[model samples]
Target chain A: MNLLLLSPDDLRADGSAVVEDRRLQHMLQVQRVEPGQQLRAGLLGGLMGQATVQQLDSHQAHLTLLLDQPPPAKLPLTLVLALPRPKMLKRTLQTIAAMGVQRLVLVNSFRVEKSFWQTPWLQEDSIREQLLLGLEQACDTVLPEVILEKRFKPFVEDRLPALAAANLKLVAHPGEHPECPRALGEQPLTLAIGPEGGWIPYEVELLRKADFAPVQLGPRILRVETAVPALIARLY
Target chain B: MNLLLLSPDDLRADGSAVVEDRRLQHMLQVQRVEPGQQLRAGLLGGLMGQATVQQLDSHQAHLTLLLDQPPPAKLPLTLVLALPRPKMLKRTLQTIAAMGVQRLVLVNSFRVEKSFWQTPWLQEDSIREQLLLGLEQACDTVLPEVILEKRFKPFVEDRLPALAAANLKLVAHPGEHPECPRALGEQPLTLAIGPEGGWIPYEVELLRKADFAPVQLGPRILRVETAVPALIARLY
Candidate 1:
């Protein structure tokens, strides 16, 4: 874990904190942290800081908090992606969070298999687990908000206007000339990546009419998870 | 697996083929192929074709090859990347291969610690393993060539000229202006990605002087593995 994340409720009234969860075990076993050792730490939804280990036992550990800096900056880009396969979904969330994306909108597309929606990974806790892994990699604590949109049209027509109101919008599709701009100026961006087989023509057109320019990532098609990180990197 | 890849030596004198390795296991277990099933197949350094499942046993499978359509088109790009951590290195090879990258030039960089070079994953077999994974994903048969350049300067100055001769060269670094263009016309591409902390200014300048156009993928910095897919998607 890059940053040891704790919840605010986990802090004791006396200002000391006890960590008895799996994270504590990871600290003790994987990191091999000992008493008095300093660790980079954070409180979920709280400040990022240094923590000094004060006590350790088989089951729990205590530490003193000292928030030193502000939380890591959130990526200015918002990603709206078609749901990927469950295995890819886990890695995608971790990567998105690690890159500090503030929001992710998982939308349904024609190419998305119906069976994919049934995946247990779509569960709330499962989603959070992946996000936490990303945060750990980046040593950040804030979790990005995730929204699920089962229907494309209603969400696009009803909510996307507001979402795109303050952002530069782009959709990733193949065969569009000149493609999307690599460096979006200072404006916030809302970028869309399609499913494995990619968006149908009508879907691409809808997004385009909604102000999302259809852009190509060259000739080679990439898998959804790989494409997400690639798009995020270029647009952020 | 994308396409079943067989080495030239795997071909028997009678022109029938036997596959008894992990590829065979993947075909039997994951693909669940039975006799008479037709699947895409390719030779490692030869042709791609349709294969009729002739027979299957617990340990091996037999196939009758019918060379038809050629192998899928490869990415018209060459990747020059600083060697990543061993884990990332494995994924990078797999991802690049899956994307149909033709060649990989793994180089040294400032942020790339010296110890990363010592990883057993740098061994040929391990690297080939990852490439096969990528090929399986794309259903392509050709394996990309992985070249290592321990010293950056000589390789950049000597070898790059010949490689960049017919391609547009791009080096991914943060802070380049007007940002990078998303796609160049259908010429071959030579793209470079930096180490985790990025290429030092000197390295960036040297690359530029060596005819690589320095490009930025927006403001948020990305990990090397993330950058690879992102740049590939943008360029290819």
Candidate 2:
């Protein structure tokens, strides 16, 4: 873990914390941190700073925290993605979170298998766990909000237009389309990416009506995981 | 599989081919191809086009080849990457290939675990298999060339300089450095990315001596998998 993320419950009134869970184990084993050493840490939904390890043992690691610095700024983007397969969903969650995406809408497309919705990885706790890993990887504290939309039409027709009203709305599709814009300088954006087979023409039409301009990266197609970072980097 | 990749042995003198492997299974189950149906296909290291399914069954699928179109252009770049752990290595290989990176050098660094060098994923056949999957995903016919460097100092001091000579040489380091360049259209580039813990000062110094300019993505640290696409997108 790049940064140890602690929940409010883990902190004491005196600005100290005792980590006895996976974080402690990871610090002891993977990081090989010893008592009296300082490590970077952050509070979930709070600030980030350094923590001095006071006492270390097999049971727990007592730390005195100095949380003074604010977390890194999130990207000014709301990502609308067609829910990927279960295995990909887990990694994409971590990727999007690590890349500083603040909001995500996992919507359905015709090509998305109904079975994908039933995956255990979509459970609240499972999703949070993946997001936490991403936060730790990126050394950030703020968690991105995730919204699920099982039906495509209602979400796009009723909600997407308003959600994307003031933002640069884009749908990343491989076709005869303009290249995705670069370094748009912090404008709020909403980008839609499709399932493995890509958005059907009907879905594309619906999205187009919702104001998402179709854009292409190049002729070569990329997987959802790869596409997310590529689009984010190019846009901002 | 988006494109069925065929080896020379799979072709017949009569301009036909028989698929009796995973491609056949994918065609039978995933694609559900029938006689007289056409499917996108590509020859390994060759052109891409459509194939007409002349005969189909569980045992095999016979096709008439009509190859014409050229594969997508590869990035005019050579990537120098610290060998990641096995799982990440597998995914990264697929990603680089799909993103049209044609030349890659997997090198050793201080933080790269010794066991990473021994992974079966690094074997020629295993690497080829992953690259093929990536080519299939991207619908391209060309396979990327992968080079392995087991020793750190020798490779960097001896070979990397010449390999990166006359190219825009960049080393991605997470620290105070210039932001990575953008849209340097079609310039040949050689980029070096480090292991999870990042390149040590010594390594960075050696790379600097070799004439690589250090570049940073941002404050947020990204996993190697995420960084590859992000860097490629920004650079291209």
Candidate 3:
């Protein structure tokens, strides 16, 4: 883990801290951290800091935390993806976290199989594990907000507009006019990618009306997992 | 499987065939083949064809073969990658095959752990299995040639010039001038991507001198697996 993420409840007074259990095992075994060395640590939804080792044991580690500043601001991007297979969903979340995305909305698509919604990875704890992997890779601590929407119409008609307001919104679809822009700089954006068979015509039209401009990633059809990296690389 | 790949020895003079064993299991059980159904099939290192089911039994399936024209030419691209971890190496090879790449040269990089080179995935037969997966995905049978260069200095100094002749060579590096092109049409191109932590400064400079343009995919640092898809999406 790049930054050991801890909740505010886990902190003790006097800037002294104790880390035990899984996170501690990861630090001691996977990272092979040594006593007298410093490691990056942070609050789950708060600022990051450097922690100096005070004591080390097989079961726990005590450290002195030097909290100073909050983590870097997240990308002004919110992604709305048609839920893919469970394996892919995990990887996409990690990738999104690594890219500094802080909000995700998973929705159902016509091409999405009903069976996919039953995957265990969609459970809150499972989802959080994948996000943590991404945060560690990016050296950040803040966990992104994740929401699940089963009905497409209600989300598009009732909720999407509020999110799209004041942001450049783009939806990735094949065969659209005016290619997707190459860079967005510091501006916030909301990008939507459809399921394997792509957004159905009606869905695309609704998204377009809701201010989502259609974009393409070229002619060859890419798998959904591959498409995630391809779109994020271009948009971010 | 998009294409059923077969060896040359499996072809019959009468153009009738019997497919048994692992492939038979996949066709009969996984794909649920039925009489009169047609599937895309190809001869390894040869032409692609259409196969029609004539009969089926518990052990084997009988087919009528109609060999047709060769597949469309592969993209004229050469990939130079730092040898990835064994698990990732397997998938990467499969992706390369599916995309119809013609050549791959695995090189040494600072961030590439020496242990990675010793992976069993590099065994000839294992590598072929990964390539077959790619071929099946693309409905094509042509296999990309694989090369391994353990020594960095000798290969870069001697072989790189001939490899880059008459081709656009680009290196996928972060924080570089002139970001990776979004599209390059059908030009013969050479693309390079680094290992987990990326190539050291000297390695990147060596590639630049060999006429490889250094490029970035914006500010987000993508994992090598993700970067491969992004690079291919931009190029092919």
List the candidates' TM-scores in order.
Answer: 0.69, 0.99, 0.81
Residue pairs that clash (backbone atoms under 3 angstroms), model 1: A218-B236, A219-B236, A230-B230, B2-B136, B2-B139, B3-B139
Q: Considering summed lDDT, which 10 consecutive residues are worst modelled in model 1 chain B?
A: B176-185
Q: Please say which candidate is ahead in lDDT: 1 or 2.
A: 2
Best by lDDT: 2
Sorted on lDDT, best first, the list reads: 2, 1, 3
- Encode model 2's per-residue lDDT on A42-108: one tens digit a residue: 9999999999999999998999999999999999899999999999999999998998998999999
Q: In what order do the candidates fall by DockQ, top score first? A: 2, 3, 1
Deviation of model 1 at A11, angstroms: 1.4
Residue B174 in model 2: lDDT:
85
Error of 2 at A73 (Å): 0.5
Instruction: Please give, as one word, the docking class of candidate 2.
Output: high
Return the TM-score for candidate 1, rounded to 2 decimals.
Answer: 0.69
TM-score of chain B of each: 0.92, 0.98, 0.95
Query: Model 1 over residues B79-147: C-alpha lDDT tens digits?
Result: 999989998898889889888888999999887889999999999999998888787666677788889
lDDT of each: 0.82, 0.93, 0.81
Q: Model 2, B214: alpha-carbon shift in Å?
A: 0.2
Name the candidate that leads on DockQ: 2
